[model samples]
Target: MIKRILLVTRGCAPDEFVPAWRAAMGAAVTAPPDVRPSRVTAGIVLDEVTPEPRHDAVGQEWFDDEEHLSRYESWLASPASAAVDELFGRAVERDATDIVVTGEHVLRGAPWFERRWRDGGEGLKHMALATRAAGLTQAEFFDRWRNRAGLVGAVPIPEVARGQAYLQNHPLPKAAGDWPYDAVNEVYFDDLDDLRERIAWFAENLAGNEDDLVRESWFVAVREEVLWPEATSAGEGLLPGRPGGRGTS
Candidate 1:
């Protein structure tokens, strides 16, 4: 019954942070009510944004969890997540990842989405993606999640070259809009039939539109989440799932 989300914004410039913050905050104001209900809790963490040695920039996020992820999911899927997504687009150099936890909702979260750089390089990408619907056992879920998170260590991936290509080039590229890609996405559904239908629509409807700049894309469903009990207890106010920033761990 807890939802965790990690939004890593890669390849960002120092100047862009303020603008990105504004855009993200602005979107929060206009987000749809259905996607994210009122029960969720959120926060942001500014950590190191480099790969170490060279010390470059990495990803970040607008919010983290506070034992109210189900509520957060309601807000995320609601117009709010979308609004936050749009604001982030302006500030982020490439992309972000969204991790959600559910209690009452039919489905849960752990979907990862990356953004492409200005020059068409994969700006951001998902390192690991898993969910309850994906058939993850309880042990398997937490193990993989922790393993991936611990691997990054302190430095974050600042450029697209450091991230996985699937973040940018998946089955299709997602169109940028006022909402966050992870929120308002058709990926999370309890009904297998509904999930199948949506997937089919993307494949079939996306075939002829190769030339189109903005095409419908693929968003996977995440099944489970893991939280840092220490983070909350410490009151550091750090955002979960996001990587280190320029000077942070």
Candidate 2:
């Protein structure tokens, strides 16, 4: 599958922008089922943090492959699809917004996620915008970051026990050298406490390796709202469903 995510720093207030953004995205993704996105969710900024968090919201979409995404984006360029996004603007700050096309690697992935969050599968999400350490090339950074799976043994990653799902998303390079971060990582937890534990674990166990691999990391937290596919919801016993972000299992 192909994953595309848009990170936005809000210009319009959340109360006004959230719904408008979701509505516009819903309207724009009206492709044939084969090409339609399998997952779509809006991750609204959850806290007020330092450096002001480059993004206030995250719009994520998934498709079958590059071909499916191309077809869907081609449709998005059409007047009708374009019209649907007319309201999305102003809500998204033009300069702060970034759209990234990434290649994902699931470290610790699970099918059964115990429901600790009250409002459906909507839980605490953590995004780390990680930069490469010192002199390492992008290829070198990716190699060090991904190849550690072997050293970790049977478990996908150390923090898997605390986080329900853990993924590492590395952006494909561009000729312009515009996108700055080395990796955009995602972690969804049962709740804030679990998220805390996960962070603490990272700081304790992998701090050295992290220091060697990532020179800097800007972190953002979000409360996800699954806006598409009106259904029971994701996870067992939450709503009858397949998970899409905050969607299903």
Candidate 3:
């Protein structure tokens, strides 16, 4: 499981920005060890400046469990948190126009839809993306999928401690002719440590499971507090160059 996911703000990041970001990342790495921090998943900084800032910071962290995530959140709420606050706070105060931050246990379901699409169905292709948000627990989700659908695949992130497991459908062919639909089930964990244990267990146990399930996936663990703001359709609030589009540079 990912412990802390940090979403730093950067509008026009070039190769030069990596060193600065790395320095900021080091701040997180140095936080007090009682947090029992493990791994951090740093996403490439995305640029989308609006008139006013709005969009949650996006990043991933793998922790051992739900308890760890909760403990990390406490430091975030406490004013005595750590130098991380000072480090990020100074950076944002000097560079960010505006910023907002929040944290929560997350469930991610990413099922690929592969296969040829029929000619006229191109316009409705976006509908296939709906499954990425399904929130399902471990036992029920996997059992249902295994018995009903003959699908064979592995869990996406097996490193997290407490989370649901199941296979996502990836439709192949890609054109308009094949039926395409994907499935997702996300079960939240208490913290990063819990996630780590679950992932390890899944990896070891997967080998002995039936052949029609995912047995070769590797789980990743990450931990790090983050920064972000509210998000709307076009970038932050609206689409630039459109009738009602609104956002920053």
Residue-level lDDT tens digits of model 2 in 140-229: 988887775423222334544346776788777776865767788787876776776665655555545467777887777777755544
lDDT of each: 0.30, 0.64, 0.34
Estimate, for each residue in 1-249, the C-alpha lDDT of model 3 and write its tens digit: 433433345433355444344334434444345453444423332223112223222233444666775566676567655555554553332353321111222223222111111111111000001121135433444445545332223444333443432223232222344221222222323354465465456556546343443322322232222211112222332111121122211
Off by over 4 Å in 3: 11-16, 45-58, 90-249
In terms of lDDT, the best-performing candidate is 2
Tell me each candidate's TM-score. Answer: 0.28, 0.75, 0.33
Query: What lDDT score is found at residue 85 in candidate 1?
Result: 61
RMSD of each: 16.6, 6.1, 19.3
Ordered from best to worst lDDT, the candidate numbers read 2, 3, 1
TM-score for candidate 3, please give it: 0.33
